[model samples]
Target: MYEGAVQDLIDELGRLPGVGPKSAQRIAFHLLQAEPADAQRLADAITRVKATVRFCARCFNVSEAEECRICRDPRRDGRVLCVVEEARDVVAIERTREYRGRYHVLGGAISPIDGIGPDDLHVRDLVRRLDDEPVDELIIATNPNVEGEATASYLSRLFAPLGVRITRLASGLPVGGDLDYADEVTLGRAFAGRRDVRG
Candidate 1:
C-alpha cells in the first residue's frame, strides 16, 4: 500500500471502470514517475473535458454545444436513423466512412438483471424523435451480444406498427476468423443472413 498523496491517487484511479486496485496502483506509480508537466497536462485535459463536453441535444452523443457535428451536417441523410448503444460506437462506425445517416445514441442496452430497462435508456427519446422526424428506416446497430439483441428486439416490436423499416446489423464470423472456430450464435446468424453469390 502507498502513503499520503500517492494512496489518494491510487484510490481515485481505482474508481475508474475496469481499473482494479492493482492496476490503479500501477497507473498511479507510472504517472508519478512521469514528468510533472505531463501529469499536469493529463489532469487538465480531464478537467477541461468534464467542464466543456455535454451530450448533443439531437443525437445524445458527446458534444460541446446543443448538437453533435454529425447532427448539424447537412450532408447526412435525414431519412435513415442509426441507433447505437453508446457514444463510442458512433465513433467506431464513423471511421468506416460507409454510412451517411444521422445517429440516435440509446445511452445503454436493456438488462433486467442490472435493473436497466427500456425507461433507463433513451428509447422514449427515440420514439419521440420518430414522431418528430421524417425518418424512413431505423438501423439497430446495437452490439451483437445478449443484452444488445434484447434491446434491438424490444425496439423492433415497439416500432413495428409505426411502419418504419427496421433492420439489424448482420452478424457473423470475422473476416480472418476460421469458420470452425466460430460460435453457434455467430454461425447461425451468418447462415440466416446468407446471400446468393452471383457468378
Candidate 2:
C-alpha cells in the first residue's frame, strides 16, 4: 500500500480498464521514477486529448475536427457504410485494408444487462445519416457477442423497410484453428458460412 498522492495515483490508475491493483501500483511507481519532464509530457498529452478530441459529427468516430478523416475523404465509397460499436473498431478494420467504405460508429451495442440500449447509443444519429447520406448498403460490423447480435437484429428490422441492403460481418472459426477446440456456436457458424472448393 502507498501513502498520500502516491496511493491516489495508484487508485486512479487502477480505475482504468484492464489495469489491476498490482499493475496500477507498478505504473504509479514507474511514473514516480520517471523524469519530471516525462511525467509532465504524459499529463500534457492526456489533457490535450481530452481538450481536443471529440466524436465526429457525422460518423461518431473520435475526431479533432467536426468530421473524422474517413468522413472527410472523398475517395471513400459513399454507397457502402460499415457500422461498428466503437472508434477502436474503426482502427481494427482499417488495419485489415480490406474495406474502403466510410463507417458509422454506434458508440455501443444494445445491452439490457449493462443498462445500455438503442436509446443510449447513436441510433437516432445513424437514422438521420441514412436519410441524409447516399448510403445503400449498411454492413453491421458489430462484435459477435449477445449485445452485438441484438443490436444487429434491431438495426436490420429497423432499416429493412427502407429498402437499403443490410449485411452482417461473417463469423466463423479462425484460420489455423482446430475443429476440436471450437465451441458449438463457432463450429456451427463455420459450417453455415462454408464455401465449395473449386480446386
Candidate 3:
C-alpha cells in the first residue's frame, strides 16, 4: 500500500462506479503524471458539473435550469412522454431523431437483487406528472434486460388505470447481426415484434 495523498487519491478513485482497484491505481498514477493544467481542467469540470448540473423539476433530466431544454421547447409534443431509466437513456433517444416527444427520467430500474424498488425510483414523481400534465401516451423505453422488463411490467400495471395509453419499445436483433449469433430471447422478441411488409 502507498502512503499519504497517493493512497488517498487511489482510494477515492476506486469509489467511482465501474472503477476497480487496479483501474483506480492506474488513474491516480496517470493523474499524477499528467500536466498540472490538464489535471486542473478535469478537476474543474467535475466541480462545475456538481455545482451547476441539476435534475429538471419537470422531467428529472439533467439541466442547468429548472426545466431541461426539451421540457422548455415549444415544438415538442406535450401529449407523449417517453419514460427511461436514466438521463443517459434520454440522450440516446435524442440521438435517434425520430422521437419528437418529451421524456420522464425514472432514475433507475426496479432491481430486487440490488434492493431497489418502485419507492426507490422517481415513480411517485412520474405519477404526479401524469396527473398534472396532458401526457396522453407513455412510451416505456427501458432497457430490454431482465431488470428492465420487470420495471416495465410494473409500470405497465401501475399506469394502466391512469387513462394514458401505454406502449413498450420493440426489442429485436441488430440490423446486420446474423441469425446464428442471436440468442433465444432476442430471436423470440424479434419474431414477436415483426410486422408485415407493405409492398
Candidate 4:
C-alpha cells in the first residue's frame, strides 16, 4: 500500500495491458526515483503520440498522416494486400523485410467470447479497398490461434466471390524446435504445408 498520489499512480499504471499490480508498483517507484526531467520526457512523449498518431485512412495503420508510409510508397506492390489483426502485426511483417506489399489492419480478430465479431472488425473497409484498389491477392496474416482461424475463415469465405486470390501465412513447428515438443495442430500444418525438395 502507498500514500494517496503514489497509490493513485500505481493504480493508473496497473490499468495498462500486460501491467500487473507488482509491475505497476515497480514502475511507479522507478518513476519516483527517476530524475524529474526523465519523468517529464515520458509524459511528453505519451502526450505527443496521443496528439499526433492516428489511423491511416487507407489501410488503418497507425500514422501521423492520412496514409501510412507503406501505403504512400510507390515502390510497394499495390496488387498484393496482406491483412493482419493489428498495427503491431504490420511492424512484425516489416521486420522480416520479405514482403513487399501493402497491408490492411483488421483492428482485431473475431472472438465471440470477447463479444467481437466480423462486423466489429474492419472487414467492410477491406471489401471497399478491394473494389477501390487493384488488388490481385489477399494474404491473411492473422495469428494461428482460435480467434485468428475464425477470422481467416470468415474472410476467406467473404472474399472468395470477389475473385481476389486468398492465401494464409503458413504455421508450423519453429526452426530448431524438436518435433516431440510441437503441438499436434502445428505438426499437422507443417506436414500439410510441406513442399517437394528441389536442386
Q: What would the TM-scores of all predictions be?
A: 0.97, 0.97, 0.95, 0.97
For residues 1-199, what per-residue lDDT tens digits would candidate 2 score against the true structure?
Answer: 5689999999999999999999999999999999999999999999999999999999999999999999999999988999999999999999999999999999999999999989999999999989999888999999999999999999999999999999999889988999899999999999999999999
Give residue 148's error in model 1 in angstroms. 0.8
Residues 41-79, candidate 3: write the lDDT tens digits: 999999999999999998999999999999999999999
Which one wins on lDDT? Answer: 4
Question: How does candidate 2 score on lDDT?
Answer: 0.95
Steric overlap count per candidate:
0, 0, 0, 0
What lDDT tens digits, residue by residue, belong to model 1 across residues 121-144? 999999999999999999999998
- Lowest lDDT 10-residue stretch of candidate 2: 1-10
Candidate 2 clashes: the total is: 0
The residue ranges of model 2 lying beyond 4 angstroms of the native Cα positions read none
Whole-model Cα lDDT per candidate? 0.96, 0.95, 0.96, 0.96
Q: Point out where model 4 deviates above 4 Å.
A: none
| C-alpha lDDT of residue 174 in model 4 | 98
Q: Quote model 2's TM-score.
A: 0.97
